[model samples]
Target: MPQRTNNGFGLVRRGLAPALALAFTLALALMFMAESAQAASLSSSRADRRAARNEAKTQAEEVPLTPETFSHKLVLDGQAGSVLSFTLPEAVHKGLELTTFQDLCVFDADGTPVPFQLRAPQGTNQRLEVEKELPYFMWQPEKPGAGTPGTMDIEINAKGGIVRIKGQTDDLAKPGPVSYLLDMQAFFDAASSPVSRGGLAFADDDLRERAIKVLLAGDEPFMVSVTMKTSADLDSWTSIGRPQMLVRTRQGDVTLERDTLVLPGTAKRYLLLQFADSDVPIFSFAARAVFDKTTHEVRETIVPGTLSENKRQIGYTLPGRFPVTAIGFDLAQAEMMAVRLSGADDPEKPYAQRASGFIYRLERDGVTVTGEPFPVTQSNRYWRLSAAGDIPFAAAPGMRVYWQPRELLFLARGKGPWTLAFGRQTAVQASALPMLGQSDVQTAREIASPPTDTGATTPAVAKKEESREWVLWAVLILAVVFLSGVTVWLVRSMKK
Candidate 1:
């Protein structure tokens, strides 16, 4: 057939025979694809047999099994619970024998003698000594169990005996695994510093009673303020007129117990205090407080900073005297509660410093706070929250966030709700704003019995009671900062 073609059509038609053949080839590829898929359904029978044979050979090999008269070695490589077990006949009596009753052999990581003495079989002595040069452990049963060879349990009893096996099982004579253990510290004393005595001064009467306790914790020092007070509850605070001890100072190596805490309280729920300037390295601070027989629930966190070289003063003034108030927190929970007060303080003479404070609700849900999601408290980071009326740990529908008229952080947790005060010489003249009657939940426990004179009736003492009020006001005022700045401050302050 003569195919009609334009000049271009003829050029295209020149390969027509090849084009028809190409279409046939494409059809052939599709048919072969199905066969390729079928081939994928199966593997090489010879390769499969070889893999099965290799696995079976591995299973047949014994894991270094030996008769009761065997001495094997193992390396721990610092991994916890990497144990070395050996099966031996009663004939291997050189090492301490272990039974379901007690441990067989014990050795410290530094190759020291433990208090325990291994008791072996009735006729033989169980004593295994470390073979010098070789890191292999030598052990024999102190006493064989009732009726089994390897079935008997080997128990250890001196609290917990950790065996630091070094090197590899094959190379027990040399070191291999270079692993360290966190458990190396059974009970490490990780304290920072402790202070006992130093120089402290008081202006007024130079009179104060101070109980200082220095704790070695975190990489910094923390302090809590306590007033030698008298109260029925451990909440309301009142300053005493007579200075019991004036103040406490530290000048030597600090111990754990005698680390004098400026504040006084056996309660574990401690108030952590630190410096305002985060970089201030505190050599030590003096805690000054007036002690009275009838004072109660009176204390403020005392933090010492720049005392050795610079001016030393409390972090807060009668709010407004200075522009900022410094607060602290448990150095551990720095994220939870940290605050400072600024913008108020009375400076004039006869300076009747009235205590000032902000009243906010301690709202929470399970473990989370009401509005502030992040555990952060910087300037203006607070969200307005409704102050639910007086309620226990239980949340209720009636809870509404309303601004309290009171200025101080004294409500239900301390003396009386309205009886609380802040930064004042006395509770009577703290804030100008009067507080509403505190719900019973805020009142602290009253002192059971005040110091009584002969035939004299003791006055009613007040304190903080058990309530769900966990306000961050105090923490905000005293940021328990660590002396990470000591590296710098020590060099500058110390007149070496």
Candidate 2:
């Protein structure tokens, strides 16, 4: 019995060792196959992304300006042999896949390509000098009998408008210097006038240095030294350094005059002009604020956005890829709320904060005051608004996105009824063509036309691509299952 048991155990050990080795080898092979498959899938995905990008670049470079290639079309009305220009419609902006409008082209009735140039809606940078007359009132001493100047207590409203001005006297019967208060709010409010509207629109840094031109119309030649003090709320006053001398001397033919004063740094809402000598004679003078306005002609398109709620935050997605300039909100109710605006090009990626501040739509003094649009320079497609605190809206607020439209200038070459072609994914930017100056070209009228629907993929092609992906996945899954079965079989054999 012992001899038989030993022989049987030896046979069992010999059989188990081979099975164990086979199972180990099969497990290793399965792991290697899975790793190779995973690596290939990753490599394929990266290659697809790169190929898509390269294909877009190639399309933009090689695609011909044919009506069939573009997804949208518009008719141009102008004479041939003349350079024509037109502002791109809002529909063009909505249909464009490229930010720079590289797919844009103009073709004649004969399908011949026309040379063209793309320009900003607003032409180029232009510098303008704007001057506005300031309203002023003089302050006098509280006691007329007192020979000394007295201090003045001034009150201002929320809009920085002066509400009241009262003179106060000290216990010693001494008074403060008499001063002239000028309403400097006109320089800060851009919407006050047409000329000043563009003044503050583009350049915020240029508003720091304000030029005050004073016109003194007095018969006698007088010299007076004046000191300027600025105040936002009449309570706090900031002195603008040393006093400046204002002199108007008369010579034989030429008159020597110093009438301009430049205030450095940020300007306040109210400016107080005080004379150095209290005994200086009161002269009739007019003062105006001068601003160096730099403006760029910009064409704006406002597109309504779709709103969605994401947990505590609200998000918005625009219908098209827009070079967003500003964001405006339409509140459901009159309320003030502080929100942080964030944006991203892709919805899957994290959004970056663009602007943060208070926005309100309030009714005050029988007037509706809506907050100005927050400025942002991004071409992002997704936007989110998060409340800064515990503020919650009664209803989902409506949003409007503002963007600048590109201008197209094309030379009319073949015939009438030219068509503008655009909206292609693979199209590249066309080479610039030198044509007649804008002053010499006539503005072409844009006639609305239906889009071409060139981006629609056929059902057959989509099915083929889908099947190809499924086949690849199925092969990988089968190989994994076969290796797993082989590994299990070897383990069972070792047990036997």
Please give, for residues 81-157, the per-residue lDDT of candidate 1 as tens digits: 22211121211211112211121221223322122211111121222111111111211222422111121222222
State candidate 2's TM-score: 0.59
Q: Which segments of model 2 are wrong by more than 4 Å? A: 1-28, 52-63, 123-310, 334-338, 349-352, 360-370, 386-396, 427-438, 449-496
User: Which stretches in model 1 have alpha-carbon errors above 4 Å?
Assistant: 1-158, 163-183, 187-320, 323-388, 391-496
Scored by CA lDDT, what does every candidate get?
A: 0.24, 0.67
**Compared with the true structure, what per-residue lDDT tens digits does model 2 show for residues 1-496?**
3455545556557676776677668767766766676667667766776776676556546755577677777888887788888877667777777655676678899887878888766445444455667766676556553332222466556666765565433332234456677787765564233343533343544433456777665556767788888876665778886788877788987788887777655557777777654444444443343334544444454444444453347778777666678888877578788888999877899999999997788989998999988899877878887788875655557777777777788888888788887776654455576645557788898665554564632112112334445665677667667766876675566556
TM-scores of the candidates in the order shown: 0.13, 0.59
Candidate 2 displacement at residue 243 in angstroms: 17
Instruction: Give candidate 2's error at residue 46 in angstroms.
Output: 2.6
Question: Best candidate, TM-score-wise?
Answer: 2
